[model samples]
Target: MVTRREWLLASGAVAAALALPARSAFAQPARTVKVAIGQKTIAPNLVNLLIGEGLGYNAAEGFKAQFMTVGGVSNAQVAIDRGDSDISTGVPSFALPILAKGEWGKAIHFYQYTYPYKWDVAVKPESTLTSYEELKGKNIGVPDFAETAFPVTKNVLRSLGLDPDRDVKWTAVGTGVAAGVALQRGAVDALAYYDTGFGQIEGAGIPFKMLPLPKNVPMVGGQFLMALRERIAKDRDLMVGYGRSVAKASVFLAASPRAGARAFLKMYPEAAPRGSSEEDAIKSVLLATARRIKLYDPPYAGAKIGSINPEEFRIEAQMNDMKISSFDAFLTNELIDEINSFDREEIKRQALAYA
Candidate 1:
């Protein structure tokens, strides 16, 4: 016969054993985070996306991205509109016009990074055509007929004193591998390929060079990460957490360039060129990616999720030159407020190690 004290102690021990297993089970459950990819290729972005997945960052934040490359802003917008995808990447310039046409039921703009990420006029390195001026009368391959790529290409051409309408020819090819095929076959004199796509082509032993833009020319508009606004608001904490995560990631990329590159490659093995040291190539890529990252500033520099500035007044002015009056309508950073409230220092610290 046990004393009352011993009886109580035995009961407590039983409860503790039961609770231990429950805690372990809860910790082991895999969370799902559905994200949509705007394109189908593995390039600069795959590393970030992969990091979110491989490192369980997305799961920790309660997300599992269902990545599909619905190539072009118009197509990506339509996917979000139809409820087929939850998030997408699109030119800030084009998103406003699409939303202006009607109220979208889901998907909202949460954040943006003004990385003048490279999407250039690529040609075989052996070719003698050295200047943008030579693009006159050339057949330029575009990923989509209606998307940011063509507009950016045209903007660059005009910046070089070439009339996009009459000076150069445009062709619409599907993105990634398909666009590379067009360039390889000489079906197009120049192709507008993003840095990642360019890397893939280069990795395939195809000798191509991105036509360098004048240092001041903007090839890509400021880009934003868009999701269903209502959904984002409902899960405001998660959305803000993501913003904090990206801010952390951005700062990490800037401060620890080598570590960040390694992290990126680990997340997306396909991001690196075959037979090339992923470590070294990422360093080269980061050197270039860093400049573009600067364009977004604040949220990036301060590692604060929701910070934005009107300094893009210059970029807006550039859009105005394109006769884009609707520019201001879609550039909303209101949602970033939720992200700013969280502690992002650690995430950024971890992410920079990937650089």
Candidate 2:
């Protein structure tokens, strides 16, 4: 098994750390948390974080979220593992592999950031590839080889009766415009990535024929809010505060997706399209965020927002071949009640009044 230190050194954790230059957010901050995201782009996947910032949710919680993106989910997890960041958002599959390899004490996922399997495989316009089976021997362009899509693609191919190592070629096409360009120029035959990434790709004016997820793999869990176990143990208030803000942000977004998009643009004004009018830009963001918003719906995420569903993790580990000794070993719902301690109607009221 590769030790955590060895993996960090080999994975260029130092470089990843540098990419996320130190910055601060709140002035009288009780806690300054370094939050790592998968990609740098201002896509819908990150709108909740933006909402948290624009709406002052984090500030109200007494902690400041200093955000950074290292391009992929695995790298984001690595940021937490290397102590480059105190918390990160990632999938259970990404963290399980690390735990299966004995990389303990790195981090523990406590809150469900996203509530469903949001990844998908897509072929560019004019391609006849209707099924994932057609992906055999085809080039798959992903954001990163260590990303959630990488392992998910591998498992998907396996379930489709294809040998992933021998049947497919994978390339790191980054995200958004880079991914769109790669597919446009035929650098890869198919694009395997997550929800908001595809949203950005579509915004590039390149249509896509999305392939359905393989039916055999029972992957259910999605992105999560992860922090060190020690951090949660010693500083419970910080974890509860941060996650509570995120949960409220989720509620605010669900209450009004358009408002969420508006909040996103408000936080990152440059994210607004270059020549487009304000309403048009906000509409584009709404379109990009539509699918992701569905994942956080009441029916899918269930009544307890941000709570851990053990069955989901069990299925995730089983399908991905991670030897998880126990579901509780990697996650906890103990903080769920605390994280969700927010008034839904108040968030709805705020969303309605959002500029």
Instruction: State which candidate has the highest lDDT.
Output: 2
Q: Tell me, what's the RMSD of every candidate?
A: 14.8, 2.9
The runs of at least 3 residues in candidate 1 whose Cα sits more than 4 Å from the true structure, single-residue gaps closed, are 1-31, 41-43, 62-64, 99-107, 143-147, 172-185, 255-329, 337-355
Residue 21 in model 2: shift from native, Å?
9.8
Off by over 4 Å in 2: 1-3, 10-30, 40-42, 297-303
Write one digit per residue (lDDT tens) for candidate 2, span 181-251: 88888899999887877887777687787887767555564778888888889989888988888888888
Q: How far does residue 263 in candidate 1 sit from its true spot (Å)? A: 4.7
lDDT of each: 0.56, 0.75
Writing each residue's lDDT as its tens digit, candidate 1 over 79-127 gives: 5555555565655455543344443235566576445545678887677
What TM-score, to 2 decimals, does candidate 1 have?
Answer: 0.69
TM match of model 2 to true structure: 0.88
Lowest-sum lDDT 10-residue window in model 1? 17-26
| Model number with the top TM-score | 2
